[model samples]
Target: MTIKLIAIGKTDDKELVKLIENYQKRLSHYIQFEFEIIPDLKKAKNLSESQQKQKEGDLILGKLNPSDVLILLDENGKQFDSVAFSQYLQKHMNSGIKQLVFVIGGPYGFSEDVYSRANGKLSLSKMTFSHQMIRLFAIEQLYRAFTILRNEPYHHR
Candidate 1:
């Protein structure tokens, strides 16, 4: 199964960009992976928080195919340890899904439309994090999950 991570906005920090890329490269060795970025909306300053989320949601939904299993990274979503996450991934792969899509919403979170369309949600932590940082964290965790699955030394129980 292919894993695709879709996030809104660009990461201006070169260090974060490099680290995210590193993890993405490592992940490719395990399964087909994609990192797609939806450019930040223009004239966002004039829109309210809800309006912004709606516009961002539209863009996000536009990138998905009907067969893609959508998972949203949300604060209220289910939380799992590295090992459990790996098992979750294995379950999806075992189900023979063509593509598993995970999305990181823009500021102010996801719109109702986006939430309704998601198959599930995942939370990295209860603590809040910047979108850029979340990108790196999510990617690293994905890489770590794969390593754990293969019994690599990367994760120590």
Candidate 2:
């Protein structure tokens, strides 16, 4: 199965970009991983929170294939430990899905339509994080999960 991460906006911090890219490269050894960034909305200051979410949601939904399983990285979503997350990924792979898509929404979060389309929601932490940092965390967790599954030292290290 292919694992795809879709997030809004680009990462401007060079350090964060390098870290995220490092994990992305490591992920290639285990699975097909795709990181897609949707450009931030133009004139966002002029739009209401709901309007921005609606627009971002449209672009997010547009990136999916009919068979993709959508998972939102939501603040109120389920939380799992590293080992458990690896098991969760194993479960999906065993189920024979085509693509597993995880989305990190814009500042206003996901729209009603986006929520309705999601197969599940996962939270990395209870505290909030910046979008750019979350991208790195998510990618690193994915890498760590794969390592755990392989009985590698990285997980314990």
Candidate 3:
């Protein structure tokens, strides 16, 4: 199955972007992986929080296809350990999902429409993290999950 990460805005931190790219590159060895960035909305200052989210949600939803499995990276979502996550990915691959899509929403969070569209949600940790940093974390976790699946030493117990 192909795995795609869709996030709002580009990473401004060079170091974080490099790390995210590194994990993304490693992911290509095992699967068709891609990271697509949705540019930040213009004139956000004039928009209300809900308005901004709705606009961002439109962009987010626009990238999705009907057959793609949508998963949101949300704070209140299910949390899985490394091993469980590997199994979660394995299950999806075995289930013949065409594309697995995970989204990291904008600064304020996701729109109601965006949340309702998702098939599942995953939480990396209870602690809050910058949206940019979460992108890198998700990619790295994906890399680690694949390694665990293949019994590679990249993920330690």
Higher-TM-score candidate among 2 and 3? 2
* Local accuracy of candidate 1 as per-residue lDDT tens digits, 1-157: 8899999999999999999999999999999999999999999999999999999999999999999999999999999999999999989999988999999999899999999999999999999999999999999999999998899999985
- What's the TM-score of every candidate structure? 0.98, 0.99, 0.98
Error of 1 at 131 (Å): 0.3
Q: In candidate 2, which residue pairs get closer than 3 Å at backbone N, Cα or C atoms, i.e. clash?
A: none
**Predicted structure 2: lDDT:** 0.98
lDDT by residue for model 3 (1-157), tens: 8999999999999999889888989999999998999998989999999999999999999999999999999999999999999999999999998999999999888999999899999999999999989999999999999999999999985
Which portions of model 2 miss their true places by more than 4 Å?
A: none
Best by TM-score: 2
Alpha-carbon RMSD, candidate 3: 0.9
lDDT of each: 0.95, 0.98, 0.95
Candidate 3's error at 51, in angstroms?
A: 0.4
